[model samples]
Target chain A: MIGVFRQWLAGLPAYLWGGWGAIASLLLLLAGWEFASQWLDPLALPDPRTVLATLHGLLTEGEAWAELAITGRRALTGFALSLGVGSALGMLAGLSMTASMMARPWVTVLVGTPPIGWLVLAMLWFGASDGTPVFTVFVACFPPIFIGAMQGVRTLDGQLREMAQAFALPPLQRLFDLYLPHVLSYLFPAWITALGVSWKVVVMAELLATADGVGAALAVTRSQLDTAGTLAWIVAVVGALLAVEYLLLEPVKREVERWRTLA
Target chain B: MAHIGVTAPALELAGVGHAYGARTVLSGIDLHLPAGRIHALVGPSGCGKTTLLHLVAGLLPLQDGAIRNGFARSACMFQQPRLLPWKSALDNIALGLKARGVPRAARHAQARDQARRFGLDDTALGQYPQQLSGGMQSRVALARALVLAPDLLLLDEAFSALDVGLKAELYRQLLAEQARRPMAVLMITHDLMEAVRLAHAVWVMAPEPGRIATHFRFDDAPAQRSDAQVYARTAGLLDDATVRASFGLDAPAPAAPLALAAVGGLRC
Candidate 1:
């Protein structure tokens, strides 16, 4: 018990220093913005407290919650779809050269094209429904996960495979014992990056083509000249992203890495 | 010229030939591995000794000849342990059985049973390879190989990295375990003294597209030979003209000159 506490205490200074550094930088930026507003144009960049006040007012309104929920749902649904399809296809491609050759051109095209370009085409096909945003999110997220998984399986040690063969390990055991553990390390990072991009793309797609979401709210605020409201929605998006990263994905990543910790 | 009456041998490689691209690494190689005995394959580096071991383990397909096996299962210990860095020692040991279709509950029980025989404590089993000493990690690897109770075992310099005392200790442990259940072992090593101590029959191969140069059969019991005696016997075999030529050593003059030199017992 005492040892755990001592370890925690030793880590406290680093945590505190990081927190203070962020706060100090933010304060300096805000003070400069406020000083600039007094001397020159005020409409360019607002102070931090004004943005916080705008955030508080936005949180009290019912429409803001609805917008945030719509954006969140689209991101989750699209990310889940891409993750399932991408991982399965990636594994298949990794196992068979013919499959990889067939899929390589499409993977390259999908990853290379600008995501907004796809959103415009999706809007033309689906006519500005939730599908447009969801499809854009899928395109933005699939490539990284696919490539990571394929490379993970490809780069597995040949000696280990030979060892497995000599032992006559079944296919399932080969997957878990020799393959999956090696792949998971690469896969998790790709998944994390994919999820983050999916959220951002979903919002951008919603802003361009849809009538609902935080993106729509930002669009609405832009037309009305409600700059404070626009900043508040941006804050809300950032805060939610931070929450999901810390409370959900990071915990799962740590659990997957627990064996390493034991080492 | 040489015979051991090894009928019903555990493994037989008859006119085995393997080539990569245009270069033939092994050609017309014949070996008869007797059941429940240690056979050493000794040669200089790049003599295709490792390739032969891999062939016996069924990692490489027979290209031009036949390998008749008397055993169903074969276990291999690589030059390095080649352990899974992500897994604990016990998990690594259990991996062979898991691959062999053993159930999880039963595999852990069997792994624990084998680990205890290898002098591995529960804590040691729980730790990863990086956390264990080199000797301890090698022991775990040996346990992993032995746990499968393979009919044939192939080792590629399995103990060459250990200190002299530790290597001797591991040899004793391995022999004791083999005594409990007889296993046919084919090991490749550059250490002639080690080969002398452990091998019932040592087959020496020449370099550059390897072939069996000759063989030495130890007349003394493995338990009866001290390190010095083992070294001396192996040195005497190495003094043979063909063995010396393979290793790029200076060859003695002629049959009479070598016979006279042998009579004089000249030590270099």
Candidate 2:
């Protein structure tokens, strides 16, 4: 078993190094938090152990998981809707100069408007319903994805287009086989950015507009003066964000770009 | 091996002239390519050789004259191997067939067979264009062109980027393919030796409203010509006062026969 473990470790030296470094940093941070907690009241700044225990209790009780699921669903719904609509519009803008000119003002307005302002407007429009959080997430995430798709289409290599024309490829074949792959290079990074913003915006909307999801739970913890529980909820949100990015987005990006060589 | 018809010339040009805005690039150009003949166009830079090829390939609209092509399909290989970076070598080769509405399985099978004939092994066929060497990329490009089974093949300095050994090998492969299935080839080159080595006839083009200055036809097959004979012919062509004046090489003929490198800059 030790021999097998050693071989496994040897096979992934880079991951091993990164994992050890992360563990060391986390331990150092926890120690600093522990030291700080000793100087303050337990209610003001809870120790790392207390926060860990609170997290463990929350996990076992299952309420935290339900809140997490609600938040995740809202964020994902908003993200999927925005990605589909934003990419379609972006492609239209990229292809037609008139469309691009018309879209510039709207995109600028959407990007400039703060998420809190949209959350307030959504609350006014949809009241206390789940639509508030979903709308907030979509508004916050759409701009980056739109801009990325537009730039991607605009910056495609001219030589490749010429080649396609010279070969007389049909329009649909060029779109699927040439344009899609090239556009993905720009679209992937925008997707990751949109996803992170979606999570944050969804929680903020939930905190203000509804008594559901992690944001609402954090509100309850704040009212009860349970600082450690609030910290635990924050940690859970971060963990979920990292999981989506690393597990889903990164693998797809690597697969799409596998044709590239360092040389 | 499939002949559409025997009587028609492969390609014909009459009074072809092109202008970019108000500036004329070519004028009064007349040329004809008979079936199964390899013709080379050699000229100084900025001559309309490439423009003429594009016109015949239907990439550019005719400005002055007319172009007639009897071939149902034509293929061109550019100076650079314009392979789609996202595609594997086999997929790049199959692209034209795919565009022509060939079924996926059959085109891929044909592409694989064509790849093997171009001296590309299975390993090379599976690689992306960037993953392969320059010579290998050229081979893929050539394979991509040939897979169409074109009746007219257009090459625009296609082998200029390759080293001598690779270029010679590709020349041999091209000649072998031509022998098996006869096709009219119109190649534009700055390399005189390459023109002599491959072309049955060579046309010398002059600039400033680019037009053919003269033409020379070789009676002997390209494979039968010796280096001495090639050099002698090259020297004879370079000796012409008009050819020298067009190239801006007005000096009296050098005591030593002109080497290929000496005339490299004169190529279009």
Candidate 3:
């Protein structure tokens, strides 16, 4: 664990250095936003400066973190549930031809049904509770995680399996060493996608069902014609997502993938 | 070989036959490898040399006969490197030890020692298999097999895919390992001269039930044999009617050398 941590820390400088291009691109986006805001009514679209100021006010006032936490808890609870169930079921289904074949059209159906449709159904089933948003996030996020795990299992090289058997790997070693490492490459991308999906779907669910959370706050700002407040909430949500991705996940990904990735 | 006591057992096969449903790939095969001798099974592709090897290695179910593999432990190397792409070279070479439940630090230390002997540097051991060159991958694969210190080692044309230089280097490494470790080796290869240069006994297989057609023995030690002797012995083996029939290389006497050259082992 210390070795992997050291490797990640050693590679941190280059990883951060690569972020300059990202910052430049984001700054260009702010410039575009500033230009486009010149003609629009403030209610329709706020300028970037106004949005930043509003976001700063929300942070200093200290209420934004509570609402963000509520929404994060719902999204992440659902995302965690889907990540576990989807990865497990998908791998089990992939082990057999009949199971996978039966699962394909079902996966297609789940992926096809929009998150709004699921939210409506969840609201009907679970009322105005947290279940509505949590269930919606899970349903919206299941297909990609499931498919990633299934494909990972299905695409494992037969020669490696044979090699493992010939070497007589213990069951635990077979699981942790041989299977887990191979599947992780596929699972990480799917998990990231599902996490994004989870966030978006949970917000949509909360906007319609919940009386709290950042989504409810956005709904409040919408009613009051407060475009800057709405944009601030959006910025807060997006910033949180970016922080989770870059700060937490990307470092772990680099640590696991350093074998194939160049130093 | 079959008459030995259980104390120092060698690999022995008796009347072993294998059939995939109705298609028989091997039949009536009796073979033996003394504890520390090297044996090569030489045959053309589709002659079931692989199936026979698999049966001995317990990779395939035995259908018609029995194999008594009394070696304490064994490991195999395939035509491909077969290293897990996600693993570092040290981890790959340590696979068998890991399976045997050796602790991480001990296995890694042993793997590092073996990798260094195979000419892999410390940086190479830290890197993954895909990051290395093909020859380097092959070395890692060989190191993976040898780190087990098995009494028997199986090679399924493990060197046939390499260029001549790489093949020669691996051959040297194999001989050097054998000098210190003294294990029985059973390798399958289509290259008749590789068999002649490396094996104490070479068994040729013919298709359609894949029975052994000829057995050739070399009295000279493989490490001491010169390139010229290998070539001359290969030429002499090619002239045998059974060897020609097994390889489908029946040619007029004057054109025999040309036919033998085209039989695919003489390239630099």
TM-score ranking of the models: 3, 1, 2
By DockQ, the best candidate is: 1
Q: Indicate which candidate wins on TM-score.
A: 3
The DockQ values of the predictions, listed in order, are: 0.54, 0.43, 0.50
List ranges where model 2 is wrong by over 4 Å.
Answer: A1-32, A35-41, A96-106, A261-263, B1-9, B251-268
Ranking 1 against 3 by lDDT, winner = 3
Candidate 1 residues B161-221, lDDT tens each?
8887778788987788777877888999988778878877888888768788877676445
Q: Which stretches of candidate 3 lie over 4 Å from their true place?
A: A6-10, B1-4, B20-22, B251-268
**CAPRI tier for the interface of model 2:** acceptable
Which is the leading candidate under lDDT? 3
If both were scored by DockQ, which would come out higher, candidate 2 or candidate 3? 3
Clashing pairs in 3: none
**Which of candidates 2 and 3 is the stronger one according to lDDT?**
3
DockQ of candidate 3 is: 0.50
Q: Alpha-carbon error at B259 in model 2, in Å?
A: 18
Against the true structure, candidate 1 reaches a TM-score of 0.87
What value does the lDDT take at residue A25 in candidate 3? 96
Across A1-263, the per-residue lDDT of candidate 2 in tens digits comes to 46544544454455445667767887898899999999999888888888888888898999879999999999999999999988878876887778777888899999999999999999999999889999999999999999888888888887787778778899999997788888988889999999999999988888889989999998899899889999899888988997788656765565567676422
* Model 3 alpha-carbon miss at residue B232, Å: 1.9
